[model samples]
Target: MNIAPRYLGRGSWLARRDPRVLIVGLALFVFSVIQVWDLRILVGLALVAAVYYRSARIPFHSVRLQWAYIVFFVSFIVLANTILTGGDLRDVKSQALHVYFRMPLLNTPLSAESTSYAMAQYLRFLSMAAVGFPIAFAVAPGDIGPAFARLGVPDKFAYALDLTFRFIPSLAADMRATIDAQRIRGYEWEKKGRGPIGKLTRTVPLLVPVTVNAIVGAEDTIDAMDLRAFGTGRRSWLRELAMDRTDRLVLAGFGLLLLAVTAASLTGLTRLWVPPFLLPA
Candidate 1:
């Protein structure tokens, strides 16, 4: 529900850098992490992400809502994958959290291997998410259009992409405002906890207002754009961007990092790694 615009007042180093470089670097980092399973590589990626997050100077609480869902997702992955892994069942079990449940429809032996693998997968995703913080916290939605255009994307597509990013925060803010207004009017979901159906019904009051507001906002935006002769001619950004020496240096570093990650992956260094304590004997 923390829907305040993320990039309005941020003045961090990453926030001041060229959006094109940031976009490309983050894209590369995310791509590399998706194919990797090695703990060392995952940890390293996480460290790099942490450096950026710290440098961005954005409050951690602002992004905590997203990470909260990520934690739930990772937990579900660990529990589900741990039980569903196939092969010769060794009657193995995880030594870390020694909790075992037996159900009629579910009967698969758990092991430290599955647990470790799941943790690795979770870390891989977490690190990728961390690397994405700058996009959400520092990069203004308006900059995306110019950055993509500079990267050779078509003007129309770049404009659409920029609008998509800008709308996300706007929608979130609208939803939060609707919820707050409903709460003030004495609407309570917790008091009517009659299961999923009740929850759905309760949300109606919040959803209807948000949807109407979104439609109204979209129409206004379209009318304004049309009035301004948008998309009728060559679309140029208000401020032209040129890559400075710092931008060049940062881009070069990202290129080197990409090459190193690719080399490591090809050399079999990106294989799954289970911590010794978590590895089944």
Candidate 2:
């Protein structure tokens, strides 16, 4: 019953099918999700990632594990930002609306446009999160590192990124072990009392072990890199990754998207944003 999904399908172990395509696909996915405050683009990007996730064969369950967390986090952010803030970048006194805003007159009336922009921006965050759900699950850290490295990302930064990816599984395993150890010692986290202080007591010990383990893992990684002569010179990729027609197509699609976003931002297209009818008119 080992139905676990791997990162790459129908490709070499290192995903050598097409580094260019993977690089562009990943970049497009990230850049597009972040660049806009529009729901249409956000939904479009999420659908695109869903397709990519299926193609990549990354486990859907792995991603769904955090669905509740994502929902809670995004919902909280959107609600807080929208309700507490106001104003758009186009406003004469344009203030960057965030969760908390500083006002010269705390009692001054908030503008409708500011409130709308705040809500829109928060929706923007939710949209990006929705889009990124798959990437968090489907893209294996090991599989994408070399492709990113070859795509002109600085070698040191690439290595750091690779190592950062590697930490996920390590952190997960460490958390499980720590939780089990705590449970065996008669500490019941869920059954713990309410309030922030009780929550802190329950989580503090769990985090300490995870942190210590992370440090130990980092040390091991440093030692291994030193043995391999890391940073001594330009190191060759373990395997030669190439570009396929599909990869080219996807990347080109992103180039087109980049152009579109550039045009929209430059031509004041985004200035036409309007809040949905459910919002204040």
Candidate 3:
């Protein structure tokens, strides 16, 4: 089942740039987001990511599934943090009634501080995904190994990373094929009859076939690579990834941005900031 459409297109400037540059810039961007525990700073980074996504021509719909995953994850984080981090409930009494319900059933306390903390963490994850998804879609598989190699990553590890990106779509397709094949035989795993345990029991059969097939495919791939003398010595990728003028500009910009953000964080200017709207006078 090919669940995702290709978000990368030929016309986008991001698609034309070097993957190594994207990887390095994205690392710095994530580092900036991590240094400051502030929603405003994270939102600023998200806005920057939005502009990059637009310039790359990656439509939101293309990555809607990824967004769904992020939403689910963020929900979990919000719930977990709200419950686990204890604070006085009186701090949030002035907010609307819905804000009161943000707490869980674990006899957990809620306060403006806790709410801000949870939100800051949630936005941190969201901002990371916002930047990450674009890079994942924009970079080509063939360039992945070379990109990592240029980063001083070991050749074997770089090749492994390249294969991982190349095979993810194929693995998804294989899973879909297996499920369809099973369904055609009057076997319906999603028919909604089973409880959790029963559902797990029903799913095991599906996993067995998929696992076996994947193992076989992996063995074949390994054999092919061995025959080609892969990883035996100095390895060259099929395509050479060179840092061009555009790549240099992007890298330099990211370096400056990283330095400025780090300086602000170290000076405590962007630490523990909660928007005024979230605070009660």
Candidate 4:
């Protein structure tokens, strides 16, 4: 099970850009999205995110599982918001809301404002995911630490970030190998024994070996690092990242976007915009 997001070998425009540029650009985009609740503005940002994602040329198949996870997470958040505070009309200027329907058991009224808020939340999260998933696919693994280092992160911390990125995939590969090994021994992982306890009991066989192996791997890595005198002195990265004219331009663009978003948000131009049709006359 290759569950880890592998870098697509395809040379898309985003993939060609410096890793630092992508990192800063994504940060700025996410911050901008966070500053606004206006559905219209969110829609525009979502379109921008869509274009940014499409530029990577990542195939649907490559990130299908990721998309599934994102959809599940966003749906859960939206549903929860609808149920918990669906009746709150605080944001409605007239303090009057048009109730669409009441939730079955909770009797919570799902009002127009709540519905609009849910849509805005949906677009907000989806837009973030759109820009985020591409980084795992587009940036080369080796460049992550160097990019962080070039962006003023301490040497050890930068390498730790790089290791963290690589570790998740390593752990996934280990889990896959452990599952296959257990399967050869006639372990039926899918067998739900009785209830929640049974489900957890079944996971023991898979988790124990993976956990032990992970601990041992960590120990080995620590020993190797110690032998090499890592963190004892200044570190020199094998790959030195340099920003070109295009990278600088891209970074400047994202900076400008952040400034514009901040200005809009501070000026109260990015408030929640309930559709005129949904307003009570």
Candidate 5:
């Protein structure tokens, strides 16, 4: 099925940047986004995220499945938030709210303030996903470890991160193979169950073989590392990464952005903004 997230091999602006720039910039962007609940600021951030994501030139077809998953997850969270606590009432500046309608059965009042809060939450998550997805779908697999190593991450941790990225696709491939084998043996995953227990039981067929393969893979990796005397002494990366002028400029820009966002948040300039319509006159 080729469902794993792999580099799209596109020669786009973001792809041209150093991997470290993307990693550090993404962290700064995430931190900045999480500091505010204002819809205006969040809208601006979401636009920036959209631009950043577009710069990677990732085709929609390549990541449609991932997009579907993200949309479903985010929608579920927003719906649950609306149903449960009525959407973070703390962010509403005024105690009084204009009730729009009451949710059936739950009788939860769907007020304008709560609706706006849910919109803010939705934008918050979408913005994060926007800038974050490029890292997985754009960066070259070979560069991950060296980039992290160059960033002063410990050698073992750097290598582990590299392995982690590559492992996901490998694991997915293994799972797909296992599923295919099961299907050949007359197993139907969809027809196996109906409820939560059915779902759990259905996974058993896929999980067991995949899990055993993963354990074997891990042992093989360990043996290979031992043969190469890994972690015994100072480790050297096969690939060398150096920051260019563009990379330096990007890092400085990211640093300044983080500082500016922190100042704005601490100075209370980025407080949640409730729509005037939501307040009773």
Candidate 6:
């Protein structure tokens, strides 16, 4: 609900860097995190993620909203995998909050080892998500649009990216308004039922009016841009980005950190898929 335009977000480190480097560096960080999952490697990644959000001027509250779904999704997968694990059923049970379960038609005892493996995989995913999301968060759509086009991203694709940035905030804002309107009409999200369907039932109604309003807003935006001859020619950027010395320094440091992670991971200095310490029987 705390939606605002992409480029208009508060200042941060990545935002201040030239869009070209921001784009390229983001790609590098993502690739590295996906391929490498050493705790040591992720130690640096965590720093990069933190620095990116800090530099981009993104508010902590805004960053939290942007990342809540990812955290929730990863946590959910971990829980499911933990319960269904064939080897260890209780690997992460203590850490996990109770989420209602749906009974399968077939009866089978999940193994602890399988569950442990699944939990490890889930943890790996979470590590990567924790590292990569902030970079994604810092990437402003306006910068991405032109930067991609310059890098040979098709104009159509670039436009799609641009539109994605434009839509996120506008849509979020619209939904917030919808919720407020519904609240006035005696709707309360907390009062909704507990099941997954309950969530869908409660949320789906808010979207109907929000979606319509979004469409109307989009039409108005298009009309306004058309009046201003928005795409009649070259796309000029509102944020003037030029790579500076600080950008070079930060990038070089991250590059070294990435190399260290790769080395540590391959050499067995950091292990990501290892289960947490368990008490001996």
Report the number of the highest-lDDT candidate. Answer: 4
Give the residue spans of candidate 3 off by over 4 A: 1-7, 88-109
Total clashing pairs for each candidate: 0, 3, 1, 0, 0, 17
Candidate 2 vs candidate 6: the TM-score winner is 2
How many pairs of residues collide in model 3? 1
Using lDDT as the yardstick, the better of models 3 and 4 is 4
Per-residue alpha-carbon lDDT of candidate 4 for residues 99-174, written as tens digits (9 for 90 to 100): 7778899988877788788888999999999888778899998899999998999999999998998898889988
In order, what lDDT does every prediction score? 0.75, 0.59, 0.76, 0.86, 0.84, 0.60
- TM-score-sorted candidate list, best first: 4, 5, 3, 1, 2, 6
Which regions of candidate 4 are displaced past 4 Å?
279-281
Worst 10 residues of 3 by lDDT: 89-98
lDDT of 2 by residue, 109-135 (tens): 345455555455555555455444434
Could you estimate the TM-score for every candidate? 0.79, 0.66, 0.84, 0.91, 0.89, 0.60
Candidate 6 vs. true structure, TM-score = 0.60
lDDT of each residue in 1-281, candidate 5, tens digit only = 77566788358888888899899999998899889788888898899889889999999988888889988999998888889874347745334667777888888788877877788889989999989898887888888999998889999999998898879887988888899999999878888448888878887989998998898779989999999999999888887777789888977976887788789899987776777867656
What lDDT does candidate 4 reach at residue 242? 84
* Better by TM-score, candidate 3 or 2: 3
lDDT, model 4, position 142: 87
Question: RMSD in Å for candidate 2, one decimal?
Answer: 6.4
What's the distance in Å from true for residue 262, model 6?
6.3
List model 6 lDDT by residue over 101-184, tens digit each. Answer: 323653333433344444455545655554445445555665767777766776657777778877887688778878888999
* Model 2 lDDT, full chain set: 0.59
- Top candidate when judged by TM-score against the true structure: 4
